[model samples]
Target chain A: MSERAQEGRTAEGPTAGEGRTAGGGHGTGGGPGRVLVAVYGVFALAAGARAAVQIARQFDEAPLAYTLSAFAAAVYLLLAVALGRGMRRLALVACGIELAGVLIVGTLSLVDPEAFPKATVWSGFGSGYVFIPLVLPVLGLYWLSRRR
Target chain B: MIGPLATGLIVFALVIALASLLTTALNKSMGTVLLVALGVLEIGLLVQAGFVVAALAAGEGPTDTATLIGYTAGTVVIPPVAAFWGVGERSRWGPAVIAVAGFAIPGMVGRMLQIWQGMG
Candidate 1:
C-alpha cells in the first residue's frame, strides 16, 4: 500500500507542474519549450566552438565558409537566449533567419559544391551536423507558436 | 586521452540517454535514477577531462589544441547544466532535456577522441 501511494504521488507531480507552468505566461521557457531551449543552447555551443576554432586556426583556408559559420553561431546563440528569456519577437526573428539560412546554404552546398570547399553548420541541410541545424528552428517556431 | 575511456563514456552516455527517453515516454517526471545516472556520467567525463588536460600540460595531445579543448570543455559542462535546467522543470520534459545532454556528450567525446587521434 505504501509503495503504491508513493507511485501515485510521483506520477501526480509532473501533471500539476505542467499546468502551472503553461498558465503562468512563461511562454517559450516552460514545459516542452524548455527542451527546445536546451537543444538550441547545445547547438549554439557547438556552432560557436566550431566557428571559433576554424577562424582562429585557419581563417585563410576558407574565409567565406568560416565567416558563415561564425554568423550561424551568433544566430543560434541569440535564439537560445531569446527563447530562454521568453522574448518572442527576438526568437521569431532568429528562427526565421535560421530557417532561411539552412535552406539557402543546404541548396547552395549541393548545387555549387566547389563554392563551399569547406562545410558550414548548414551545409547540405546540416547533413554534417545530423541535420539538427536544419530542424531546430522549425521546432523552435512551432513550440513558440503553440506556447503563445 | 585514453581510447577506452571515451568508448566507455560513449556507451554509458547512450544508455543514460535511452533511459531518460524511456522515462519521458512513460510520462514520468525526472527522478533520482536519472539524476544519479547523470552524476555518474558527469564524474566519468570529469575523469576524462582531467586526463586530457594533464596530457596537454605534459606537452602532449593533438596539434589542434583549441578544438580539442573546446570539445573537452563542452563535455564537462553540458551534464551539470542539463541537470540544473532539467530539475527545474518538474515535468516529463525534464528527462527529455537530460536525454539531449546524454546524446550530446557522446558526440563531443567521440569528436574529442578523433581529434586526439589526429584524424580530423
Candidate 2:
C-alpha cells in the first residue's frame, strides 16, 4: 500500500505531487497523516465542547480545570490544523505543549488531588481518556520528526 | 438511548473497524461496501441519537444533560466526517480513516451508555 503511494509520488515527481495534493503529503495530512489529523480533530472537539459546557454551566466549580481543558483543546486544534496544512513548526510547538500539559497536569492532579476539584484532560495523565491524551503528543512529535 | 441497540451498534462498528483495518492491510482503498457499511453505522447512530432526544424531552434521563448531549452529538457526527475524509484519500489509508471512525463510535456510544446509566 505504502509502496504504491510512493511510486505514485515518484512517477509524478516530488514537486508535482506536492503541488497537486497541496498539503496532502506524508509529512503533512496525507496517508497516515489523515488518521493523525482525524484523531487530533476528535480530541479538539471533545475537549473544546466539554470545556465550553463546563464553563458555561458551572465555571465556579472548577475554573482552573476547565480553563486547562479549554487550553488543551486549543492546542489539539492547532496541532490538527498545522498537520493538515503541513505547517511543521506550528505542529511541533503544539505537540510540545501537549506533551508538557499531560505530564504536568497528570502529576499535579495525582500529587495534589485537592487542587483539582474536577478533572482536566491531562489529569492523571489522561487516565480518564485511556491515556490517549498522554500518548498523542509523543506520537505527534515522533511523526513530525520523521516527516520529510 | 436504547441499551441493546446501542450495544449492538458498538459491536457492529467494531466489526466494521476491523474490516476497514483489513482492507488497509490488504493494500486496498475504501470501497463501496465499506461506505455502505459506514452508512449503516450512521443510521444506527442517528436512531440512537433520536432515542436520546426523545428520552430527554420526556424528562426520563440523567441530570448531566450537558455531557450527555455533548457525547451524543459527537457520536452522531464522527461517522460521516470520517467517511468524507476517508473517501478523499484514494489509498490504503482511506479505509484506515474509516477504521479510526469505527473505533471512535463505540467509545463515544459506550460513554453515552455509562452516562445514561447515571454512573457518573
Candidate 3:
C-alpha cells in the first residue's frame, strides 16, 4: 500500500499544483472523501446483507436477478474497501466496473423487462436507491481524477 | 406500536439530525451536548424496542419475523456505531455521521411500523 501511495504521488506530481489551487487535499483521504467513504460503507453493508438474505431464501425464484444482486453487492463491497484504503488504482477500477454494471444492467432491464423478472440494485440505474448508484461512480471517478 | 409515540420519536430524531447537519455544515466540532442528545436518542430507541418486543409477546407481532428482527437489530446497532466513528474523527464529519445515523433511525422505525401494519 505504501508503494502504491508513493507511485500515485509520483504520477500525480504535476496535477498536485493544480489541485492545491482547486482546494484539493491529500488524495482521497480528505474531508469529502471521508464522508463519501462512510456513505459507501453504509450502502455496501445494506446491499450485501439484503442480497445475502434474498439469495439464501429463494435462489430458485429468479436466478438471474438474485445473481445480479449478489454481483452488485460484491461491487459495492469492493468499492467501499477501495475507497477506505485509499487505493487509487483499485478505486478507479472498481468504480469503472460499477459504472459499467449499472449502465449495462439498466439498459438490459429496460430493453427487455421479461428477462429481469425481478429488480436488482442496478436495475433502472438504481432507481430504488434514489439513483445514487448511478451518481456515486461519477463522483468516485471525479474524486480519483482530482487526486491525480 | 403507538402511532403518536412513534411519530413523536421520529420527529425528534429528524430535528436532532438536522441540528447535527447544521453543526457540521458550520465546520464546528461535535460538543458534549450533542453527544448527550445522541445518548438520549439511543435510550429512547431502546425503550421503544422494549415496547415493541413486549407488544409482540402480547400477540401484536408483524408477519415477517426475520425482517422485523433485522430492523430491530439495526436500530440498536446504528447509533453506537455512528457514535464510535464520530468520536474517533472529532471533526465536522463526526457530527455528520451522527446526522446520518439519526435520520436512519426514524426511517427504520417507520419501516417497522409499516411492516407491523402489513403495509410493507
Off by over 4 Å in 1: A1-25
Candidate 2 lDDT tens digits, B1-120: 788999999999999999999998987877999999999999999999999999999999999999999998998899999998787776777899999888888988888889899996
Say which prediction, candidate 1 or candidate 2, comes out ahead on DockQ: 1
- TM-score of only chain B in every candidate structure: 0.98, 0.98, 0.93
**Per-residue alpha-carbon lDDT of candidate 1 for residues A1-148, written as tens digits (9 for 90 to 100):** 3443234335445454444333322457666777888998898899999999999999999898999999999998898788877888999999999999999999999999888899999999999888889889889888777655
Flag clash pairs in model 3: none
lDDT of 2 at B97: 90
State the DockQ, from 0 to 1, for candidate 1: 0.50
Instruction: Give lDDT tens digits, candidate 3, residues B6-115.
Output: 78778888988999899887876568878888888788888878888888788778776666766777777777877765654444666787887778778888988898
Stretches off by above 4 angstroms in model 2 are A1-21
Each model's TM-score? 0.91, 0.91, 0.80
Model 3 chain A weakest lDDT span, ten residues long: A16-25
Sorted by DockQ (best first), the order is 1, 2, 3
Per-residue alpha-carbon lDDT of candidate 3 for residues A1-148, written as tens digits (9 for 90 to 100)? 3443344334333543454212334546434555566667667766776677678877888899988888888887787667656677988998999999999999999999988887898999999788988998999898788667
